[model samples]
Target: MREVVLVVLQLARMTVTDLLGSLNLPEEHIQYWLNRNEALHNFCSQNETCYSKYELNNKQCWGYEASCSKKDSFSARKAKCTKPNSWQKQIFKKQADFAKLAEVLSTITPICVSNYSEGSSLECSSHLRFCRAKNIFFDFHNLNAKNSKRYRNDVIQKGQAGGNCNMLFNEAALRSRADEKSYLQSWAHELEHFSSYPTFEVSKRQCDVIFEKPTVLIKLDAASSMYHHFCDFVNLYASQHVNGSVDMDIDILWWDTVSFLAAASPKPLIIHYARNCERASEPSALATVIANKNCG
Candidate 1:
């Protein structure tokens, strides 16, 4: 029985239904054989050229088609596969937008904070207030600084702050009395959130940045770390929010992040702003654009 099954599977043209019907197998046995045949077919289709060539030759090739050998001419057409569909074109546009944003971010000076003597909670609150007054969206976690050690310990253990926003730094992380460069980088990280100027919601992951007038939700992934996870998050966010009519954008700062997202999530407009502590010394293109256009 095993030998017969093996021979039947080796024959590419033989269908499981026909094989089972001819064998007069029991109903239960027929189902088992059918399943095995399907598994074998799938495996061969992936790993064996005979199956792939047969399938490809039968289908109408979408992109640029190249000729194969004469013997297998029926299945010899090779698709160029380079031409992106409408969805792919949109992703490319988003990636380009991100690159432009990153260029702007790289040039802007970091937000200056002279002192942390009063603690970062107060400063954070002040920054938020300033943003609110200016019609910018900025959220601060651990607003009260209720437990500094707890926040630090939490960050250390979890590798992230206890909140959703990208600017999830604890008071300790903020108050370490780091150099001006570190402070500038941190401020840049926060300010970059407003580079695109979308309204933010209280939701942890879903619809973080919301544009009310336009009814668009922007997914924010500010942490420059974890490229793959960020891409996954962008894809998941788009799947949840983007309907046919709704607008969406995935905002990112790191060039690396933008590159990953470009390949991963092609639906959302990825706004990129590549900047960090090392690049703080340079003049920001974002600032220049704001200065010339009189907008943030």
Candidate 2:
């Protein structure tokens, strides 16, 4: 039975962690399998081949190179882990991935886009007023699995993962006084989330549903229906803050796969930004043109 679940997880392109808690496996048993079973360890390690240096932590496994910490072990604990670029990226090839996302969106929703906050943040979807004021966070975090000093010890990194947005980067220290003043001002953006391996739930309208083809990298599938779920969740979340109304102006941005989803479906108004493309000297506007038709 346990072997059956493990096989299913691999087929789903998921980690043992995905099946760990639900399996009713005891802690010691699971750990021993993960640490002692060479084949099992090897399988878990292959799950992250596409992560960019900016996306990994420890980076030590034979094939994988990232560190993970759940406030404590056990699948129930709150911890952080890293994910590579979606497998879909490899299957479609970046250019084709963007085209497919754009093409799919064109058939449904509207789109909009904007440049990311120059010295963006892992803090929240938007630039925090205080963050911008203190000039503490600059750009994004990208670390090599091979290096430890690359990551800020104080700022806990929650790789963009499931739960409403593609990733909710929660700074571990925010809950404590280590960075009090800034924490208070930015608390508005703080929200707890729920997640599985490739999916995260935020609200009815918002879903960080990472997509996977039988043999492809994960990609955002922002078809109109799925995005409708995201917006619906956002709207529901807004009701509590907006005095009984969800503002249409509040927008959601896509980080990594935003471009990919944008290209998959074109009819929908789904705007997105691609900073690396511009900086990568890779023809910056390639994605902008695809998402522009629907962007506000």
The lDDT for every candidate, in the order shown, is: 0.24, 0.23
lDDT of 2 at 108: 22
lDDT of 1 by residue, 1-296 (tens): 11100000000112222231233333333222322234433543564543443342232221111221222322122312255345644444334222223223223222222122211111221122111011122232212233222112111111111122223233443333221212112222333222221122223232233222211112233345686355445433222211111112222222121223443223444222221111111000111111111111
Per-model root-mean-square deviation over C-alphas: 23.8, 23.6
Q: Which stretches of candidate 2 lie over 4 Å from their true place?
A: 1-252, 256-273, 277-296
Q: Residue-wise lDDT of candidate 2 within 197-234, one digit each (tens)?
A: 32312122221121121111111223457664454333
Report residue 74 deviation for candidate 2 (angstroms).
40
> What is the TM-score of candidate 2?
0.18
Please state the error at residue 270 of candidate 1 in Å.
Answer: 3.8
TM, every model: 0.17, 0.18
Candidate 1 local Cα displacement, residue 236, angstroms? 18
Error of 1 at 78 (Å): 33
Which residue segments of model 1 deviate by more than 4 Å? 1-169, 177-208, 211-261, 272-296
